[model samples]
Target: MRLLQVVESAATGVGRHVMDLSGGLLERGDEVVLAYADWRMDRMFAEGLARLEPKGLKAIKLPFSREIGPEDLRSIRALRDLIRTHGPFDAVHGHSSKGGAVARVAARTVPRRLYTPHAYITMAPTIGVRKFRLYRALERYLARLGTGTVCVSHHEKAHAVGTLGIPAPTVHVVHNGVAGPARGDRESIRAELGVQEGDVAFGFVGRLWTQKNPLLAVDAFARLRAVHPEARLLMVGTGDLEDAIRARGVPGVELLGERNGPQTMHAFDAFVLPSDYEGFPYVTLEAMATGVPVISTETGAIGEAVRDGVDGFLVPPGDATALSGAMARLMADPALRARMGASARERAGSFTIDGMVEKIRTLYAG
Candidate 1:
């Protein structure tokens, strides 16, 4: 099968998903091509690509922009030309908003196409009501053109059908997957981070965006400090809100920005994400895979991944008190955290890269 994955920015979760899915497809004897817009501003893209390219995958750079303008039309035309040159791909899977628009438009001249909105633009709190409605209308228009829409979470599928008025039948939920950690020397990582053997290390991993609500996590940690003074917070990944998160002045918070591979999973005792919204964050899955008890907001499909009081705890979105309480519970009880962490690892095993790849292959074949 000839598959083309179109994505705007090769930066975060969506970029990583494109690389992982494409690489998995190739490993399964499918020919895959990943075409993404250049991310000149994001150093992480260059760094991530350095690791991804060596995995026997082909990546194409294309011009793409978030704003719809004259240059964007030119980009669409250029994308059309790329599709024409690499004609009749078995499937064209699109990721992100700009990529979805370009791919769906280009697919009109092609055969089969699928779009996976990593997180719909309309769902972003930063988008105004008028613009959000307009984006939803546009997405509805695009949904009519594609073969099918793949949502990362059930909550996302619900929004696609309920909020955006997309037909329920057209949407499919395939949660993000991650490879389990390689049984890293956690004590060694803790030692390097100057954390003692008995100190509980709380971690959060993701971009420092408003939607991630890193500041809320800081506030939650601040509350947790009262109960468990020795608890430390380790944050992974960088974003525009880095300074703001740092400015929160929360004690024992270590910001280890932009780590990839094994280092990403190591140096954590538990994982917490207080995202305001999401389309099934990969960080939560990755954390669970690393045997870390997760405490996250009930954003998008995260609730499906975590069984509250079983694998992890789920607080309401933007509820600092609830988040802080959950963290405190885990921090104060080592046995409970360990049991929940083990269950989280077991839950994550069901969402392996091979399982996700096979599901996509089946979808493509269907």
Candidate 2:
């Protein structure tokens, strides 16, 4: 099959998703062309890009800004031309809102044109009502141009159908998956984080934004510090609330800016995410893959991924007390953590990159 994957705002996990999906497709002997927006690409990504050249992966830069601007017109035209040049693509899959819109409109005649809104803007409570209404209306308006809207989680699919008013028949849920991580050097990773072997280290990864609620993580960790003075919390990733979180001077809290997810997982005894919302958190999944027990809010399809108390614990979103308790529960019981971590690794097997791509491949054929 000849496939074209369109990704807008491929700066974060969405970019990684495209890379994983495209790489999987290429390995399966599919001819794949990726046209992605330029947002954030680091040194590691540069090396990945170069490696992809020899693997028969075709990538094109078709930058799309976050806003609805004049550049969108050019992007649409470029997409249409690219489709014409790479004629008769078996499928054209668009990722995220902007990419979904442009791909559907530009290549409306494609036999199988699928769109995946990683997270719909309307799903965000922080987005004002008026803006949410406008985005919802836009999504509904664009549904006619695409063959299907792919959702990464059941929660996202429900929102698309119930809240966004997209036709139920038009939405397909394909949970995102990751390649299994190679075990990292535990001694070296812990040394880097200044977390000694005997001390329990709770870790959080993702931006310091309101949506992520890093402040909640800070407060929760602070609560645990009173009881478990040796408990260390490693907060990875920086964002808007970085300064505010730092100002609190939360005891035993260490702010380690963004690091490679798989590599740093070895430093954590347990993982915590008090995110207010999530489409489907790749961080939690990555943590689970590393055999780390998780304490996360029941957001998105997290409950589907994490078996509360079995693999780890799930608290209500924004409940610092509950989050802290869960963290402390893991810290207090090493045997429990060990049991949960092993269960987490077993549970994570079902969400592998091979499974996700195979599910998607079946969809393409159908």
Best by lDDT: 2
In model 1, which residue pairs have backbone atoms overlapping below 3 Å?
A: none
Encode model 2's per-residue lDDT on 213-280: one tens digit a residue. Answer: 98998899998999988899888888899899889997888888977767788888999889998878
Itemize residue pairs with steric clashes in candidate 2: none
TM-score of each: 0.92, 0.96
Q: Which runs in model 1 stand beyond 4 Å of their true positions? A: 40-56, 245-248, 260-264
- Residues 220-267 of candidate 1: C-alpha lDDT, one tens digit per residue: 898888677799988887888899878888878889887663454667
Q: lDDT of each structure?
A: 0.82, 0.86
Candidate 2 stretches greater than 4 Å from native: 40-45
Prediction 2 TM-score vs. true: 0.96
Best by TM-score: 2
